[model samples]
Target chain A: MTAFIGEFNCKLDEKGRLSIPSKLRAQFPEAVGNTLVVNRGFEKCLVLYTKEDWLDETAKLNAVDDFMSPDIRRFKRIFTNGANLVQIDGAQRILVPKKLLEYAELTAEVILVANGNKIELWDQAIYESELNVDAAEMSQLAQLFHQQRNQG
Target chain B: MTAFIGEFNCKLDEKGRLSIPSKLRAQFPEAVGNTLVVNRGFEKCLVLYTKEDWLDETAKLNAVDDFMSPDIRRFKRIFTNGANLVQIDGAQRILVPKKLLEYAELTAEVILVANGNKIELWDQAIYESELNVDAAEMSQLAQLFHQQRNQG
Candidate 1:
């Protein structure tokens, strides 16, 4: 299993292809090869999951008893709503699906947040303004975390 | 790999223990056994990853060239800032760490959004009020997704 970390400043070409940072690329497991799954994130960003991880996700959806719940049906539909399976070309770049590009509002500049199992693609401005936590808040969150951790 | 789907309504017992929905629990890969990793999410919620999946995440973090960027260092600190490891007991329940529970504001009622490789635990009221997309938005989102998927 491969879990990703770090944030990289990257760019999308005029053709809408974004180059994967080599350091991030190096983290891809052999099982994932060149295939990647791109989808809308819970937030207004995009998520990149390795092909192997994507398969596991699909298997989970497949196990759902959809008929038993409309929420499940809707979730299955929307969770995979604009998902695209892309391959890294020889140049280590992937064509951002136009619709997804529009959805995430990606332009020339983008940021790749290599979160655990998924990579988040965000417009640089949106990422900085929306996702960046202030130092005070982070300190509080960290303190709360450590408090519970020590208790356990 | 195991992917999860659907949202399940649940409750936190007096002891702050949450029972994993049997359906969702069934989705856990055998390799995961009873171990789980709980951490603060990018959003104001808690994220649960299978132990196997968590290990993969750590592996990615280990590969990072931290000395190259201060951004990476800060991200690493906040990303796993409040991470905790817990186990599902014989009753299939895991104790939500006290501080994490308070951080997420999870009280009696809770909602579990089993997304792909991880599960997001949110306060039911907060989830409904903050995360629920109205019908019009869902339709628009669906249209955009289908258009992009078809283009490929």
Candidate 2:
């Protein structure tokens, strides 16, 4: 099982097409084919998942008793709301949906942060500004997390 | 398929056992039995997932190609680092693992916030201090979210 990792810099052309770095492109499982699923992330970014992973996630939601809770219904709707299925072209480029682009405020310059199972597409500037914690802070966070784990 | 909803206030007895309010307990799907999965949340809180949902989520992670990326390795480790599988007792109480309790800084009082597929357990004081946005602010945040959704 290969998972996405490492950060990649890329460009979103005016026409909304993004060229996937060959290295990153190679990370996509062969079984995933050429299809990708684009959706709004929990944060202010777009989430890119292989169609295989996307289906697995949606299956869980489908199993939920939607009729039992409006909260669940709303969650399902929002989770899949702006989701789009895209294909990689001959140039290894995938066109992001206009709505998703706007949702993430993606512009000419963007970045892809590999988050284990999914890739987070962000406006480079926004990602840098919002997620710019110093190494000290990150270490502290990691330490706290590990401490709890060890203690537990 | 009934899902948990609404907020519930509960006490963590000295023994580290948390009694689930009957209302919230009623929301548990009968098929889920008494098993629950407790894990660290992205935030400084604990996430409670039914056995069914937990399996579904873990299945996706299990599908990842662990050898291809170190990020995935660290992620898998952290995500499941302090996870515990507990069960509801005859009195509807679940004993939180000591490590999890310390991780979330849980003392006597805690709040369970139903978040669609999972419930978030937070130390009452921390939750109130960190998530206590004014109604106006919440409305503003909601408006921003909806605007993006509508625009997209």
Candidate 3:
């Protein structure tokens, strides 16, 4: 499997539409004609996926036994209920809903798109302010990867 | 901002190539034009990211204090050296490095792509064997989202 990497700084238009990077756009011919799912990302950003992948994920969420506990109900309410299904327009832009935009604290100006298996959308100011890369953290992360590799 | 909120079953071709589902392609435009950084994910899977995102994350990893402790070194080695940058082809397919395939215990048959802010690539058999979205887990995950939303 190919890993998606890199960070991109771009602008979110007035309507909260982000222009999918051209290179990134080339990755999804199939998604061009169908509905795409967008929702809150684990990190302080947004995530987008295909309907198939979304369904697969939702199935697991649905399988959660909410009747078993309050935690289950809360989980369904947060992750499941918060999810939104969106369609990509011909311009290769997905309209960021006001609620979701607000959730991510996006102000419709500049946003940061960080590359991952799924793309992360972030407010430019927040992303920049939150960006704290020091030498110490790098080493720690590297070691974590090494240990996992060895264990695997 | 959109979220990719689920898991998916996928396959890695004999050549270490995994097909980005057509529908999900929109989620990863970076894979179409730029290189990807494949690394060890938290769970038993490989993580894919765009170079930009990887760099941002690596910056965080790079921030680790190398002189702090032995454990830090391990993390640095794993996350830094253990990471592989793979290119996405015109077909939007990415080649998983041999070492990564082995590290993730992928046998070149089936794999799973769990979508979130980042994509987690897992061995299909292993993913199937281990994937269990019980009510408890779901609820816990949902609560986390809710908490994050409130905080954000």
lDDT for each residue of candidate 2 in A1-152, tens digit (9 for 90 to 100)? 33554456789998999998875787687888888999987667888999888888889779998888999999899888878999999999999999889989999988776644677788988876655445675566555544444444
For each candidate, report what fraction of the true interface contacts it reproduces: 0.00, 0.00, 0.23
lDDT of 2 at A40: 89
Per-residue lDDT of candidate 3, residues A70-146 (tens digit): 98888677876657878678887778788988888887654434332345577766655444345776555655655
Q: Relative to the unseen true structure, what is the Cα RMSD of model 1?
A: 20.0
Q: Is the docking of candidate 2 incorrect, acceptable, medium or high quality?
A: incorrect
Clashing residue pairs for model 2: A1-B65, A2-B65, A152-B99
Per-residue lDDT over B1-152 for candidate 3, one digit per residue giving the tens place of the 0 to 100 score:
22344555567778888877766666665443656677766556788766666667666654544435545534443344335567768886888767667768987655546455467787777787776688899899999999989974
lDDT (tens digit, per residue) of candidate 1 on B8-45: 99999989999999999998888788878888786678
Backbone collisions counted per model:
2, 3, 47
DockQ of each: 0.02, 0.02, 0.11
**Root-mean-square deviation of every model:** 20.0, 18.6, 18.8
